[model samples]
Target: MASSRFSAALLLLVPALLAANRPLYAQTVTAGPDSSAVAANPVADSLRRTEKLFGWRVTRPKKAALLALVLPGAGQIYNRQYWKLPLVYGGLGATGYGLYHYQSRYKEYIKGRDLYLAANGRTPINQLPGAGDQVKKETSVDNIQRGIVFYRRNRDTFIAYNALLYGVTILDALVAAHLRDFDISDDLSLRLEPALLPTATTAPTAGLALSLHLK
Candidate 1:
């Protein structure tokens, strides 16, 4: 009985195998992507051009940092970050103006003190360059001295602050350039939820956790 069943199964399989092996109509039915559609796409063409343009590339971060170190705001310009240029220049310019203004005030105080001394039997006052009529008011010696101390301290403080600003500009350029390609896009998402999870103590526990998913 088993031999008879085996023969019947072979008979059923043989015709199916023969049918599978047999070829159908010879008409060609090739299926593939349409090359013309890709070629005709404007967005694809633009992307191809961009790829070709960047083929001859140099290191961007290094170049940006170098430009910034050499000249304040130059790095931002190289990175095509135009908005930062004003801030860099504004900081440096304000510092320069402050140094000039405080120095001028210090000179005025000195001239006033010297003029008062000259009028009271001391040596004649030595005129400072571009010293205006600010000393003509004849303020007291103590007031002139106090002005000198105040302006000098302010001037020194601003000088140090300016130096720090210069360093900060270079650092900003370096870090900004390094992170220029960092993705801060709308694809970023965060989620928080309460859930129960099994812990090492073999008991289910409720916990709070944060999750971030970036697309």
Candidate 2:
């Protein structure tokens, strides 16, 4: 008899538990975002923010500038000005080569000058610092000093050239992005037409009329 009572109580409790959970499930479903609302604003839903450098949005002038700053030719690529890439890289490459060449020569001459000065301008040609051939070609203390000055000047000039070229590339990318949508077609034109001009006198004078047409 006690077992029969326990079974009856269990059946009653199970129904009560299921009934309580049903309301909680209904509330959860109701609190969820409405599918209809999401579908209604398709454009707003479709738009999404992307990761960009320095908090700048991609495909903008600032983005182009930032990319150019980070990478040598990145800005031109971003701005779709592929033609300028060759010019930018070529100028940079030439300047870099020149800088290296001049710097190396400057160091060679500097070593030669130090050797000459240490021996009171009487350093032997065989003891000078440089290639065997270069030492033979210019062994005088005066000549070594002149070479040092010349090579240093050229090295500094190439450094400036590299800096200027890098700045130009970045600026070009920014300007190009800003002017991407500008209209420069022949359809937008200015023309001169003959027309009658009203003058202070009673008679009207004929003159050429200049007009601008923007298509």
Candidate 3:
């Protein structure tokens, strides 16, 4: 009877041991909460904050060029390059001088040519007796023609150069304005010095040394 009771107790203890060691499965897991959705992304979050803080905008090159076209060196001034004002004014002055000189020479050529033609017409070519008068008239006509050609060439050259100068001025203004926005910070620096070196001699030897710093 004692053996029978012991066998029944063993059977009951076996089920309890299995229940204690077996893995348990819950019908539903209760997670407290996930907070990653509320956290900010580092790069995007910083960029958004920066955009909101500073009201930075880019300047248009075309607008700056147009401003320069309307007034010489105005765009350079707008770009904060005040030193270029003298150069702009000097270029315009030189071009203006070239135009004036060309105009004066052209007018002189025209007057000289008209006078030569009138003189030739007054004396008929057939009435010239000797080879000398014929040679003189031909020489005068050639001189007047040469003068007109030279004057016209000079005038055209001056006009072309003036146009090129104006175009260059506008281009310079645009480029200056475009470069004004460039970051020009110095982040690194270097220094060199002469140092005394330890030696066997009584006097120390001087040697060059370099030092560098970065930010």
Candidate 4:
């Protein structure tokens, strides 16, 4: 009886051990219509293939620069140079401020000249007064002319500076993009050495030699 009981227990334990050792194959049973549709779609497969072919795996420095030329700081952002964004914005801000101030002053000068002429309708020779009036009118005329000239100069300066800023920003973007993939390693080093030599002369003569190396 004990042997029969042992045999029965062994049979039960054998099934349990077999179940534990069996590989659990997880069959992905898709029950939805969407899964079937995706599996049957040829367009999606083609799109995936196209995406793999033309994916985001390369950077173009010239294209980045062109994008920056279209919009400042964009290329730097693309190149992941967050620190340079402020400099680019600051340059554009300065140029814009200069232009605005120049325009405002120019407009004020024009308005003042127009009002003065309207009030004093082209002063004739007889209407020309004593030294004080003469000086006052001459000063007004000179002030207006000076304001106009300075405004034009400032405006032109702003334009030139803005153009320079644009060019520099584009160039900087191109350079940054090119350097984005640069490799810097701990193995790089630069060394400089100097040697001194004494020459047999009447007095003590010395010669110096320098050596430089980069690795």
| Top TM-score model | 2
lDDT of 3 at 167: 71
Model 2, which residues run further than 4 Å from truth?
1-51, 54-59, 126-135, 183-186, 195-206
Winner by lDDT = 2
Query: Compared with the true structure, what per-residue lDDT tens digits does model 3 show for residues 1-215?
Result: 54344335434643443344322222223221211222223333233232111254334555567778898887777667889888778867876787787777667656655655666657543333332332334445566567668768777766766666677667777666545444434887776877777789899898876755434
Error of model 4, residue 36, in angstroms: 64
Tell me the lDDT of candidate 2: 0.67
Backbone clashes per model, in order? 0, 0, 0, 0
Predicted candidate 2 versus true structure: per-residue lDDT over 1-215, tens digit per residue? 54345335434643443343221111112221221212222223123223276664454667777889889889899878899889879868977898898898888777766766777756586665543455446857788778889889888877876776677677777776656644344787888988778899999898887766544
Worst 10 residues of 1 by lDDT: 31-40
Error in Å for residue 111 of model 4: 3.1
For model 1, name the residue pairs that clash: none
TM-scores of all models? Answer: 0.59, 0.64, 0.51, 0.54
Model 3 alpha-carbon miss at residue 141, Å: 2.8
Report how far residue 192 has shifted in candidate 4, in Å: 4.2
TM-score of 3: 0.51
Worst 10 residues of 4 by lDDT: 32-41
Which residue runs does candidate 3 get wrong by more than 4 Å? Answer: 1-58, 121-139, 189-215
Spell out the clash pairs found in candidate 3.
Answer: none
Cand. 4 Cα-lDDT? 0.58
lDDT of 4 by residue, 1-215 (tens): 54344335434643443344322222323532222212222233233222121344333666577679788999888778889889889868977787787877777666555655666747632244332332244455667677778887777767766776677777777676556544445565544434444557656444444432222
